[model samples]
Target: MSPPPAESGYSLVWSDDFSGAAGSLPNQSKWNIVSSGPNSGNQEVQHYTQSNSNSSLSGSGMLHITPQHNNGQWTSARLECKSSFQCPAGHRLLLQAELRSGTFPANQQSGIWPAFWALGNDIRNGNNVSWPQCGEWDIFENAHGADFSLGTLHYGRGGTDHLSKGSARQTFQVESFHTWAVKVNRSPSNWQDETLEWWLDGNKFFQVKGSDVGDGELWGRVAHKGFFPILNVAVGSNFPGGGQPDDKTTTGLGSGLQVKYVAAYKSN
Candidate 1:
């Protein structure tokens, strides 16, 4: 493996530099564009598109996941790195990304939600494991037009009965570039002994352990398993606004998430 990046103490494991020419799609072997329009249980308004117009690479070394109102319908993109990367237990898993978003007018920011997160890899490939049960680790999430970012963990028997913890907020706007990251460490012998730390712009904010979560058993299962990365821009969820977003609420032209780079590392 290559040496660890000087800034991070872990050895680099996987990364997407988004170095393709402008208008190019992400490497097919590394990412899978989710093409489903299921309610997603989030009441999100945007229909995820598989087209490069919604998710593409730029000559500026960035990945753009833009949401647009096309033909009176809202569309966006979601990319998952299920087939390429996985963070297993007993290792310190680190994920970092530099990102920014377009400006939102007034209270309209509540209409946009962009996130960098991860979920248990078993949820896919016919494992038949459902969400919440499979676990979710939100490394970064910006809601509405709030001047802060949030990091959270979700795991439980079901969505409604889900248990979660780890809400560390950093004061920052979506229009400006920022570095967001999270490091997860699970004990080699005891899954229950796990720690998750959150960081923004290189400042460590909060840390939580498996015991910190509401349910010890549920959170323990999540700590023991492997997870994969997901990048998406959602519109009008319960987080940003109570209802679905429409033409007036959504960003007309300059709205989307711009990711400069995404990288994962493992402790030596």
Candidate 2:
């Protein structure tokens, strides 16, 4: 297990320990289960489900987001934080989670894509925002059982034309528990002067400044305000080879993402 991150000069603002009874659902007041299967603009094969079978709490203080294959179809869960939990500018926002993948057959974890990410809250507040223009922060993403995770930021003029800068593959075992995190320090008066950093197991691996992001106008309007957290395990998306799951190779059992806990903090 990775050591907990240093807490110097920071105070915890919110957190989910997932300490409910086994088979129970996530805390409704904090998270909303996304129940749509819309292409997700990624041509993913999984149908996001709100049922406890896909997203549930284990008696042992953890959240299990399992993906199952039924009758040649896939079902998973995507949980988004409530609007009230947005992280605003001027304050340092930090999100940390202990994550690990479930067991899998030998070399059969090819299509599994589990991600812990954040989307700008402006898009959801009826601000007439769109992808890329709204900005996206990928805290951690593991594609096709790859031994390394990718931390990236997507923002630009529009959906068709966007820019991205990512970390250089931080390696880790998929089945082993590891701490993943992203921290953003924003200027109170000027959001463009903000700095973003990514960490794996308490070590900083990537970072970028708001000024480095594409356009100043778009960055301030879309990214400066704040963002909402999202957790999901997608099966067979464009990032993982853009192919459907092979029934012969994919096993539903032990093919999920496990979260020990998730928390947010404000830096002093």
Candidate 3:
């Protein structure tokens, strides 16, 4: 499938349409299969896996991150982009994706959570700077099989505690594809004045300026620093649900996270 067109003054920087033979793994050079404990450990019960059974190409230009339940364990998939992207000085950066919430009904999706988000590259590259300080930007997140989604920004002075800004809750077609995006604007004359905006299906729902953070230094670390993308389905945690997969939750594709594409654009 063709990638979505960039904004009039922007050009494509990187993208993946997930076009390939069905069941194949994602392109290795473009993504790293994360095999870990619930990705940052959110009290989630699923362990991300490297198996195609968990994450694979749909052969129809889509990527599927499915979660499976076994004899007594739950397993899922998580992928991190191999590159870090940022809004260049005097320009802007757009991170977007086309996603659908599987085909399952919200009520039966107990513990199901899917998201498209990013974390500061410092943490990805093991730069030694810990979380919160490194920053986190959540472009889209749906939990507990809810009918709505959320967007958020996380940053602070460097510790377990952090400051966060969340977008207004918005509902969308539960099982249909929709565009989710976040744009980082760096056109401000001053580095401390950059901003981040969140959009859902072309509608701007939230915007936050660096000044809103109150700490110029903290804002710079989140707004100006390079960040990489992440796609994963976690099964319950401190997230909204606060519950794990129950008997009501179905396993397999019906509860998976489907993505048509993931792309980044830089304003010309």
Candidate 4:
């Protein structure tokens, strides 16, 4: 994927254009298709699977993570990057994706959660660790098919005491492609003053500085460590207040999350 428009100084460090044959899974070397080991904590209702029915390539340059209802149960897919990524001390690291949600109204989309986010690389198998402690950056998050999207930072500790802040919700047209991105700019001489910016369709809507987090260690969890990208579409989860899909909820491809591309860049 090319760097965001006019960002000519950025060099592509990694990217996935989703150009595989129709119905194939994403490149295994670059991503892990999570089939299990989740849901217990999130209270999510959908069972994540590696089935093509849930995730596949469109052959026309797109990755589709479809959420479907079957036999009174729901299922979906999630893909996590295999490599840890971070911006260097004097540069910027940019993460961006072209994505669109399924067509449906807010009421019908209740309990549907689609996201493009990241977590610290420290979170791995057999490590037995909690989230946010490693830190998180939510580049794109939408719930209940809301007209707005949120960009949030999760730092400090985890659970009840976890520190969190979301950008002022920015309204957008859903069901159509939009570019969601986050730039971790390490331009400041002091790490505490560096900034994390959130952008949509080339327009920056919100930002937060390390000073805003107010803790060097906590800030370092996100700024100084490595993180990987995640793409998933969930249903009936904790984030949506435990709401479940009703008969009105659309299933199958109509409710899938379409991803045209995802890329990472480093500013030169």
Candidate 5:
């Protein structure tokens, strides 16, 4: 619970330990789920299901994606990483994950967005190279019941050439299980240095140095190789605001997005 970051050298290898067997799915050697119906910014609609209400694994360790309500609309959970453990490029990656449930339904709010990401496996489909230059790494995201959460970085021409730095909503305190992280550094003095950092349960709530990424004609010199890792839960456009589902008190905000394990490290 905040002891896993070995100073700043990283070395966890890879982890999922959601135990095993529960509802099956995520363990195809490592994980490689995509089943279609994902892309979000193209326009949300909700359609990534492995069943067991989207995802499951609870022999005791945890790992659940439960967001039920299909046919009438609402099916989530999208996993990633296509081979054993990708993201080799120039090396420098550390992605962690942990989440808790309960909150969402304020007019449905678009459709309950929840995520932890990393992309760029060539971007697929003939590889024409589209979407932030086939590179994106949103450490974590929670749009709707917004109490604060985001860590973005999308490259040239994919979302208006994005770049982000975040930490708001007072920082953290949305009902436990917080250890979302990301730290990727390429190096070479500058080429933007390639940076991003976010942590709440272990402090350090924000950072995005590296001179602010792209639009200046391909940030960080491309050649990022081909990233990986991603977990999802979506439905809605602007946010949970477009799906409609608000008003179900507990402490305030309400919806779904419950996960309890996801890890990757390799910074040396």
Candidate 6:
């Protein structure tokens, strides 16, 4: 079935419309399945897979990506479009998505990490020598905290050298769905100044003043290039602290992340 007519006053620039192809991916034209854990900095223990079994649209506008426990390890699906479908650079853009925690949820602190975000459009070709410098926009990231999620920006240097522009906590009722958004723009000097915000059931909750893109030069320079979107659910990582340090692999509810759909709009 086709998507409902685009909402009045809002043009549908891009959408996954989960109303079609339940149990199957929409199309390569919309999303490129990412199959690896190398770019996943969270130290998550799940191998990203690209198959209908791992990611599919279920009827009623819901997409399910259950991380499965197989071969003595955990594996799930991750999707990206680094070079394939780069978002127009230097334009104010919004990355939004409706996501739900899996059926057999994994909230083991050290387990169940799901996120909706974007990266520099040139990351696939090795253009991003340093993150955040290359640019990253995390719209919504949940760490299994009773009903709270996190929004953050990591750039300049990786790990300890990394500088976070801002971060916030919001209580999330995962049993239901919510809309998460990240608005980004750059200054004349090419520094990427961004704003992070979100809501549960259309109720405002999380917001933070994003990092200043052009304020400093200690870590080279920052640009206002827009990045493509990334949707994934990982096992565990040092970033979303709360998990057991000893548990290095993904366990608990095998099924990983579930996404209803994703969209983006240019801020006029």
Candidate 3 local lDDT, 15-42, one digit each (tens): 9999999999999899999998764467
On lDDT, the leading prediction is 3
Query: Which prediction has more favorable lDDT, 3 or 5?
Result: 3
What would the TM-scores of all predictions be?
0.87, 0.89, 0.96, 0.93, 0.31, 0.75
Cα lDDT of all candidates, in order?
0.74, 0.77, 0.87, 0.84, 0.59, 0.57
As a whole number from 0 to 100, the lDDT of residue 41 in candidate 5 is 64
- Candidate 3 weakest lDDT stretch, 10 residues: 236-245
Candidate 5: misplaced stretches above 4 Å? 1-14, 21-62, 68-91, 96-110, 117-137, 140-183, 189-192, 196-209, 213-241, 245-261
- Minimum summed lDDT over a 10-residue window in model 6 is located at 186-195
Ten consecutive residues with minimal summed lDDT in candidate 5? 244-253
Models ranked on lDDT: 3, 4, 2, 1, 5, 6
Residue-level lDDT of model 1, residues 1-268, one tens digit each, is: 2222445557878887888888999777888898977365787768888898889987778888888776767788899985434446667877888888657663655567778988887687577878888888898887666677778888888657777776746677656888888877864556556787888887888777766774666765566567788899887676633456644565542567888888888777
* Candidate 4 per-residue C-alpha lDDT over 169-218 given as tens digits, one digit per residue, 9 for 90 to 100: 78888867999999999989997889999999989999989889988888
After aligning candidate 3 to the native by TM-score, how far in Å is the CA of 251 from where it should be? 0.2
lDDT of 5 at 172: 50
After superposing candidate 1, which stretches have Cα over 4 Å from the reference? 1-5, 38-40, 84-90, 106-110, 187-192, 214-217, 240-242, 250-253
Worst 10 residues of 2 by lDDT: 240-249
**What order do candidates take by TM-score, descending?**
3, 4, 2, 1, 6, 5
Which of the predicted structures, 3 or 6, would earn the higher TM-score when compared with the native?
A: 3
Compared to the true structure, candidate 1 yields what TM-score? 0.87
